[model samples]
Target: MFYLGIDVAKAKLDCYLLTQLEPLKGKAKVVTNTTKGLADLLIWLTKNHIPHDQLHVTLEATGVYHELAATQLHDAGVCVSIANPAQIKHFGQGLAVRTKTAGVDSQVLARYCAMIKPAAWTPPPPEARILKGFLARREAILQDLLREQNRQEKAESTVTPELIHQSINDSITFLNAQLKKLQSQIDDHIDRHPGLKNDLD
Candidate 1:
C-alpha cells in the first residue's frame, strides 16, 4: 500500500508520497489548498502513474483547514486518515526526526502512517455539517446581540441619537427572531435522528 502524507495549512498543502518498502517516492511538493489545486494534485499523481486505489492519504487536523481537502478527497473515492497531532508527533519522535518543515512533516506523517496503518477517516454527513454551520451562525448572532445590548446600556441617556438606538433595538429583534427559527430547525433535525435525540436526552 502506498501512503500519501499531507501537511495542511491555510493557503497550501505539502505532500509526500511513500511506499512500505521505500521510505519516499520523490521530492515533496506544495499545492494551493483549493478545489482546483486538489484536482491538479490528482492529475499530478496520474501523470506520475500512481494508482488512486493504491494510495492512502493522511494528515493532521488543523481546524477547518483540513475539512475541504478531506471531503474532496473522500468524495473522489480516495481513502483519508485524519491523524491525531499528538500521536503523529510521538511517531515522529520514535523515528528520530529532529528537523521540522512542511516537507519534513509530510514525510514523517507518511512514514508513520506506513508503519502504523491507521484506519481511514469518514467525513461527517452533509446534514450534520450544515446543522453545525447553522449553530455557529446562531452563536455569532447571540454574541452580537449581547454586545449591542451592552453598548445600549453604556450609552443610555448619554445623548445618543434616537435613530441609532432604534436601529440597535431592531437588530436585536431580528437576531432574536432568527435564533428562534434556528432553534426550531435544530430541534427538528435532532428529532429526525433518534440516536442524536437519545444522546441529547
Candidate 2:
C-alpha cells in the first residue's frame, strides 16, 4: 500500500507519496479548490497505477481548504483522512525538521502518515459543510467590511465618496443574504438528522 500525504494551503497543495523503506516522493500541485484539480489528481493516480483502495491519503485540517478535495476523493472511493494540525505539528516537532520548504513539509507529512496510520475520515455531511462555508464566507465579508471602513476613515474628507460607501453597503447586504441562506440549509439538514440536531441543541 502507498501512503499519500497532503500539506494543504489556500491556493496550492504539497503532496507526498511514501512506500515502505523508500524515501518519500514529493510533488507541488496547484489546487484551485475546484473539481478540475481533483480530477487531475485522480488521473495522475490512475496513471501511476495506484488503486484508490491501496492509496491512503492524509491531509491536515486547515479550515475549509481541505474540504473540497476530501469530498471529491471520498466520492471517488479514495480513503481520505483529515489530521488535526496541532497533532501533526507536534509530530513534526519530534522529527527535528530544521529546514522547512514545501517539498520538505510534504515529505514530513508522508512520514507522519505512515507512522501515525490514522483512520480514514470523510468530509462532514452537507449540513456541517454548509456551516463551515457560511463561517468562512462570513469571516471574509467581515474582514472586507473592516478594511473598507478603515480606508474610508483614513481618507481625507474631500476624497471619501458616496459611491464607495454604497458599494460597501451592497456587498454587506449580499454577504448577509448568502450567510442567511447557508444557515437555513444547515438548519434543515440538522433537522433531518436527528442525532446531529440533538448534538447541536
* Top candidate when judged by lDDT against the true structure: 1
Question: What CA root-mean-square deviation does each model show from the true structure?
Answer: 2.4, 4.6
How many collisions per candidate? 0, 0
lDDT by residue (1-201, candidate 1, tens digit) is 677899999999999877443534655778999999899888888887777877889999999899988999888878899999999999999888899899999998888777888899998777667767777888998898899888788668588888988988888888889889989988888777656655445
lDDT of each: 0.84, 0.74
lDDT (Cα, tens digit) per residue for candidate 2, span 49-160? 7898887788888877888888888889888888888887788789877787766766777787778888888667776666556566767766776776666566535566
Q: Which portions of model 2 show Cα errors greater than 4 Å?
A: 20-33, 134-196
Poorly placed runs, candidate 1 (over 4 Å): 19-23, 157-159, 188-196
**TM-scores of the models, in the order given:** 0.85, 0.69
Report the error of model 1 at residue 126, Å. 2.2
Report the Cα lDDT for residue 129, model 1. Answer: 76
Clashes of 1: 0
